[model samples]
Target: MDAVADHGGSLGRASALFPQAPLPWIDLSTGINPHSYPLFDLPATAFSRLPEPARERTLAEVAAATYGAPSAANVVSAPGTQILLPRVAAAVKPGRALVLGPTYAEHARACAIAGHTVAEVRDFDALFSADIAIVVNPNNPDGRVARRRDLLELADKMRSKGGLLVVDEAFMEVGPLDERMDGDVGRGGLVVLRSFGKFFGLAGVRLGFAIAAESLAARIHGELGPWAVAGPALEYGIKALGDDAWQQAMRERLAADAARLDALFADSGVEVGGGTSLFRYVKLPDAPALFETLGQQGILIRNFIWDETALRVGLPGSEAEWRRLEQALAAWATRRQERAMEAQP
Candidate 1:
């Protein structure tokens, strides 16, 4: 497992790294939705008071319904998915932990933090050997999905051995519905993590949930303790998660945006390998140069430390932002062409 580097949405670091670049940088580092869920006025108590127990329960119920968890008892709320990573890993005692990669680096680091010897395996079959096996559904960076039936079989194997199977379904909001393991967590030996911020475009709200059997859910909830979530976060999460109409509309919009992005990349002669609608993964020899070009032009996309040739580009927010991205890619393409011509005999 590699030490954690900047994990996207790093405009401050980007500003310092590219000091001379333009102002108001376009940050498309993470897979967060560019068009955020609508915000509204909150009651004064929601800000001045600790989140009421009833409100918290309501939020949990809403989350459970939204994510298709069996019930509110199976869902544990947290400040963010990142906070739940180590807790999820710690649910099982330290042992041989295997993470399916190249995915989110935090999973491996979290397992190590939980006192496990962490190994990242690319093959699905290889994961069956570990005491703790982690799979990111519709995996990050690349949208490779393990089938639901395959995952259930793997979970059954791990469960039989008293091991844990962790499925990070953070991107599943935009991924295949049938492939999600949220509904199966009640079968035991599995934990499904759902991220609200990515789909709702409310990362700043710091909301995430873990779905598992009631006992495991309780254990993870105990780790969080009372009032783990903030007042503003509770308000935003409750209102947004329950709004089914908004989510459906947003999903459709994101699909359209993803198609537009694919077309845009194709015109620039870049191939999109795979990614959820919220982001697109581009793996190319010139990915490094493209990353630099975007950064230098005040547009920041996510680049990887482990895979030098891989970059993740998120959706552009507005028409202006889209045009800017287009212009930046055009500039990079021109520079690339000029270099190719220079090498010609």
Candidate 2:
């Protein structure tokens, strides 16, 4: 089961693994906002027509403003950042690729797909030697952050040698704002990937962006050609990205929820590891046990294939969901305490 566990948001696999678990499971897998943006009415033309070029440009402008890019020219909107991974990796001719590790698995996979000799490296300095280097800002699951100065220095070094540095800012909405590299992509050799679905809670929308210098941005745009984004995605991106008031309020709300989750974990005797507001990281010796307990209770979270003592649990949506999680933890806590006592000589 550990080896087969792939990406998050897969209830089908969860059901298959734990067939006796309750129905209507609580999924806390991906770092997606549970309190999603309110669905709005879309015009009939959205589904009936091919996306308009003007709407694409408008979406780019909105993304540029929302993500702090220099201009719309520096942004290339795509269906999702997942699809753009290979496109960005293929920007420079295939060579060696280094991804900062124990992070998202897709970066290494995408680089390999682009015909690069991909390696996941622990040392930040080792990235400088690769033809393509990748980093996940406020890194996934662990929330490890890289210094802005260090990243910029690396970008400069990569640019000097015609290499590329790809920064995935998928979690930056709730991350440390000071270490953001979104504004520095204008200097070249750096391409920043931003996900609309994670922050806005619209993963089904399939919208994301790549920010880079004009030339590189144009290269990605050329590969995408026309109508890369759905009309509904353009509509949502325009409305959601433009709504700063909602974004600010949601950030505050998510912060409070994350704090509540941390307290719940601590009270239940599980010390939380670092994570962004959207998810909480847990490093426990008995992670598989906790996973089994929660999965039996119909609550599925993220577990890593590479690390046995790792789990990534996202925020629950409502009060009932919260209570369910609390109850599940209470049971796990009692069981853990009994096991500890029995093991004591």
Candidate 3:
């Protein structure tokens, strides 16, 4: 991971790095929703305040309800999970933090930056022995949700070791809200982080929440400065969260799209890991070339250079976009097959 190199998708500097024949690229780099919540055009005054107390209360309440963290006192708001992640690391400052690997990049980054000894638990085998566990429910990239009973048992085992279990539930909203990790939430050393921007499609607002045991919550709140969330975001998030109908529709639509995308990519000889409705991680032989090829076709998707063999494609704009992707992928697969033949005697 170069410090200043663009990795993939729309903003990747790879386009600028090879500008001779610039491709019209579509970005699937981020797992964020392509369709956004209806913005009401917030008032200028809404952002003028450093912190609007009333707005904070409302946003917290709505977030609590949305995340099933009905106990308001345990919730702390931040601009985004990215911001809260490092903050949680700093607050906990554990001697050792165990993070489930092949998941979000930010989790490892957060712990490393905080100077905590970090260990990656690769799978259930490792997780069974992992003393302190941090995981993303409905894990990122793969969208693999751990069995509820297994995860709860793991959390208990970790707690008994005097360790913390942090679960990032950012994409859990893609499924039924009830499927959230509400179990064992208030247990000592158990922290759950959620992002409002994902399911609500309000990334620009940069809103996220931290739920923990009361003592831990107070510690994190005290460490993070006052008025952490801006007034406008606070107001907007509350309204968006209150719209249960919208969230439900978004889930149903994404489920349909995920199914459609799985079928489309299957035609390209790619297998989708996990059960995500927002994005599908397609396993391919050469991700970098596949990414560039897709860019040349005006299709943008996420490819991790380090992985170099997995492409995470997001939901297409419409059925037309899906068709476009499917067609381009089919052609690419033909070319790949031709190349494979060429490599043969």
Candidate 4:
């Protein structure tokens, strides 16, 4: 099979492929929140001048509280988690890097690009002696979460060897609170990466944070230099991170939306394997056909190259989009039934 698209949210590419498809595409390709944070007007200085140090400090403080990070000293801001991944990989001297398999591809890619010998392992046992170990908690595309105790154990082992354990909790916001490791960062060699865009639905703002020990965070901050996060991103992030009421409401909403998505898949005769509130993972024998059919209907989702039988479906933003997805799934089911009948002897 050809390589699955490296990432999702590529409506432009989808449109190019299916020129005759309808407009106003219903994009559920990425795990980004559909219900975005309400944007507010910003001061002219937010656009005219460089981001104030005070604003940056405030954002970090808010992020620390939101992430339950140990302290502001442990938080480092960046343009996006994507930008920080490779930088963090490079900052840690290239060595034996072990990544929890079939998770985010970027972790291995970043390590390899930084000259580390990267290996994909299936279990935590393999991480004990590795110079670096990376995991995506509530693993993307499948939402498999490693227990916090296991992760802390691995981190302790790696720390003993003067190694690092990097956990990408990009989707953890939609997961259980106890599964997070942000507050555990002071354990000497644990680093937690948080994405501001996925949960808040502001990918365009390009903001993310890394929570680690003060020394490591300072290293990352120095590498990022001054004003790594844009002014607008700083302003927006400060507000969004500070809004506890909104966060609580969004969690409940996303959980309900995920259940709705699961029901849709079940009714369509698709089997849901696992996933977080933001997306569901389906295992179908004809996953490629389903992906193509949905794309033809101007509905895009995520498919993994390593697992051809798996397709990741994100939640629809509105009721209209939900109806569209339901109709498309109904059509797919009908076609499958017709194909089954034709194959009968």
Model 2 scores a C-alpha lDDT of: 0.93
Candidate 2: regions farther than 4 A off: 1-5
lDDT of 4 by residue, 201-230 (tens): 998999999999999999999989998988
Over 4 Å off, model 4: 1-5
- Please give the clash total of every predicted structure, in order: 0, 0, 2, 0
The C-alpha local distance difference test score for the whole of candidate 3 amounts to: 0.75
TM-score rank order: 2, 1, 4, 3
| Runs with alpha carbons beyond 4 Å of true place in candidate 3 | 1-12, 17-24, 125-131, 176-179, 340-345
| Candidates' RMSD to native | 1.4, 1.9, 2.7, 2.1
Q: Rate the local accuracy (lDDT) of all candidates.
A: 0.92, 0.93, 0.75, 0.90
Candidate 4: 10-residue stretch with minimal lDDT: 1-10
How many residue pairs of model 4 clash at the backbone?
Answer: 0
Q: What clash pairs does model 2 have? A: none
TM-score preference between candidates 1 and 4, better one: 1
Candidate 1 residue 340 Cα shift, in angstroms, is: 1.1
Model 4 residue 242 CA deviation in Å: 0.6
Model 3, poorest ten-residue lDDT window? 1-10
